[model samples]
Target: MGRLTDKVAVITGSGSGIGRQIALTYAREGAKIVVADFNEEGMDQTVSQLKEMGAEAI
Candidate 1:
């Protein structure tokens, strides 16, 4: 199991920059991600990547 197994994470401004990185990292740890951001592109990219990594992220 990952470090954050079954955890719920809500990340703001996750469309880019440090926030995005944190969101990705948390998701990789098996946590659910709430991807929020003003940048639609970044948000979509993050969402796609998280899904590819087998994380339940949005």
Candidate 2:
């Protein structure tokens, strides 16, 4: 199991770049994610990616 199993992380600026990478890592680590960003499209993209990884997100 991952270190973040059963955890939830709210990541700001997760639309792209470092923030996006962090969200992905956190999700991979078994954390549910709340991806927040000013860019709606970017946020949606991140959320979609998270979903593909079987991670919960909003």
Per-prediction TM-score: 0.90, 0.96
lDDT of each: 0.90, 0.96
Tens-digit lDDT string for candidate 2 (1-58): 9999999999999999999999999999999999999999999999999999899999
Our model 2 lands, by Cα RMSD against the true structure, at 0.5
Q: What is the per-residue lDDT of model 1 for residues 1-58, given as tens digits with 9 covering 90 to 100?
A: 7899989999999989999899889987889999999899999998998889888987
Error of 1 at 29 (Å): 1.1
- In terms of lDDT, the poorest run of 10 residues in model 2 is 49-58
Evaluate model 2: give its TM-score: 0.96
The number of the candidate with the highest TM-score is 2
| Candidate 2 wrong stretches, greater than 4 Å | none
Q: 42, model 2: CA deviation in Å?
A: 0.1
lDDT at 43 for candidate 2? 98
Model 1 lDDT, full chain set: 0.90
